[model samples]
Target: MHNSKNSYIHTSAKIYGSTTIGENCTVMENVILGYPQQDILLQVTSQGKQIEDFEFHGCDIGSGSFIRAGTTIFSNVRTGSRFRTGHNAMIREKTVFGDDVLVGTNVIIDGNVSIGNNVSIQGNVYIPTHVTIEDNVFIGPCAVLANDKYPVRGEYHPIGPVIRKGASIGANSTLVPGIEIGEGAMVAAGALVTKDVPAWKLALGCPAKITDLPERLQSLNKI
Candidate 1:
C-alpha cells in the first residue's frame, strides 16, 4: 500500500514499476499497464512520440472526471478537467480532450487530435490524427475517421479530415481525410464521406452526397 501526496491508486491495480501516475486522479483495480515494452501489440503512441514520458504522462484530469476501469491513457496527452472514458478505451498520445468529454468502450483515439468539451464519442470509434472534433459533437459507435486519402508507406504528417462543431457522425460511417465536415452537419450511418460536407447538410450513401433541407440540422437524426 504505497502512498503519494496528491494521487490515489488502488492496491489491486498492477501498474508497471516505471509508470508515473499524476495527481488528483484515481487508478482503479485490475488495471494492467505494460510500459517500456517495445514489441507489445497494444503499443499506443501520442504526439509523434512513444508513450514514455513519466512526468506529465497524462494531462490534468479535472476535479470530477471518472475514468472507468481498464482504460489506457497514452503519453503526451493533455486533456481538460472532467474527461471521462469508458472501460477498455485507448486514448493515444498528444491528444487534447476538453472538459466533460465521454469516450465509450473500445474506442481507439489516434494521436495529435483535439476533442472539444461536451462531446460524446460512442463505443468502438476510431479517430485518426489531425482530426479536430469540436464541442457538442456526437460520434456514434464504430465511426471511423480517416485522415489519409492516399497514405504513403513511410511518411507521416498532419493528415486526415476535419469534423466541425455540432456534427453528428453515425454508426459505422467513414470520414475520408482532407475534407471538412461543416458545422451542424450530419453524416448518416454506413456512409462513406469522400468529399467536403457543407454546414447543416445531411449526407448519406456509399459515396456520400449532400441532402438539402429547410431547417438546419439541430441534432442527430437517428437512423
Candidate 2:
C-alpha cells in the first residue's frame, strides 16, 4: 500500500499491494483494501474478445476519503474525492465510484460497477456487478440489486439495473436485471421492479407500475 503522507491508516487495517491513497484520506481499523479475487475467467479463444484477467493489480483512492472500520475493498477499485464508507462494507474489484459517494454500513458492492458522484447507498444494500448508478442517486436500506438473469449455472451473461441521475430507491426494494430507473424516478418501499421506470415518475407494486409524481421528485420524498 502506497499511502500519501497526509493519509491516516489505522494499525489494524490490512491494505494489499500497490494501492495509491491520495491526500488526507482516513482508513479506519480492520479495513481491508486492494485485495484481489482468487477466481477469474482466463480467456475465450472462439470469440476473440479478450477481457482483462482479474489480478491484484492496484487501486487508487482519491483525496479526502474516509473509510470506516471493517470495510474491505478489492483490487482495481478506483474512486474520486470525498469517498466515504460505513462499517463492514465490502467493495469488489473493477468498481469505479465518482466524487462524494457515501456507502453505508454493511453494504456489499460487487465487481464491474460504475457509480457516479453524490450517490448515497444506505445500510445492508446488495449491489451486484455490471450496474450503473448515476449522480445524486439515493438507495435506501436493505435494497437488493441483481445482474444475472439466471445466476445458477446460466450462460454467464449478466446485466445489472441502471439507476439514472436523481433516482431514489426505497427500502427493501428489489430491482431486476437489465432494467432502467430513469432520471428523477422514485421507487416505493417494498417494491419489486421488473421493468424500466420513466423519468420523473414513481414506481410501485410488484411489477412496479410507473406514474408521474411531481411532488416526490420535487421534494425528494421519504420512503
Candidate 3:
C-alpha cells in the first residue's frame, strides 16, 4: 500500500497489495481498495491460499479522491484526480475513470469499462462491462446499461453502449447493448433505447423515438 502525502485512510479501510492512494485523498471507513477480482479471490480462498501467495495488480487512485464508506474498488482499476463516490458504490476490476468523476450511492460499475472526464453516474445505476462513457456525460438515477444482447442463450459477445460526450441519460432509462449515444444527445426519463441516437438528438419513451432536441435542451452539458 503506497499512501501519498496528506492522504487520510480510515482505520477500518482495507487497502491491499500495491495499491496507491494519491495526495489529499480520503478513504472512508469500511472501504475496500485493491480487492482481487471475484474469480481470483474465490480460487485463492478455495485453495486455502493466503494474501501474500498471489500477485495482485493493484488499483491507482489519483489525487483529491473521496471514497465514501462501504465502497469496494477491485484491483486493476485506475481513476484520475478528484474522483468521488457516494456510499456503498462498487467499482469492479479493469475499469478506468477520468478526472472529476462522480459515482453516486449504490452504483455498480462492472469491470472493463471506460469513463471520461466530468462524468456523473447517479444512484442505483448499473454499468456493465465493455461500456464507454465519454466526457461530461450524466447518467441519472436507476439507469441501467447492458452489454449482453443475447443473454444466457448461447455464445455471448458482450458489447455495451457507447455514450458520447455531453450526453444525458435520464432517470430509469435502459440502454440496449451495442448502441452508440451520439455527442450531446439526450435520453428522456424512463426511455428504453433500442438503437443508436444521432448527435444532438433526443430519444424519448420506451423503444425510444428519436427527435430533434429542444432548443432549451440543446446546449452541451455544463458538467
Worst 10 residues of 2 by lDDT: 38-47
RMSD of 1: 5.7
Any residue pairs clashing in model 3, and if so which? none
The residue pairs found clashing in candidate 1 are 46-93, 62-81, 147-160
Taken over the whole model, the C-alpha lDDT of each candidate is: 0.72, 0.86, 0.95
Query: What does candidate 3's lDDT look like per residue over 60-88, in tens digits?
Result: 99999999999999999999999999999
Supply the global lDDT for candidate 2. Answer: 0.86
Model 2 regions lying over 4 Å from their true place: 39-56, 219-223
Best by lDDT: 3
Each candidate's TM vs. the true structure? 0.77, 0.88, 0.96
Clashes of each: 3, 0, 0
Q: What is the lDDT of residue 137 in candidate 1?
A: 87
In terms of TM-score, how similar is model 1 to the real structure? 0.77
Score candidate 3 by TM-score against the native: 0.96
CA error at residue 101 for candidate 1, angstroms: 0.3
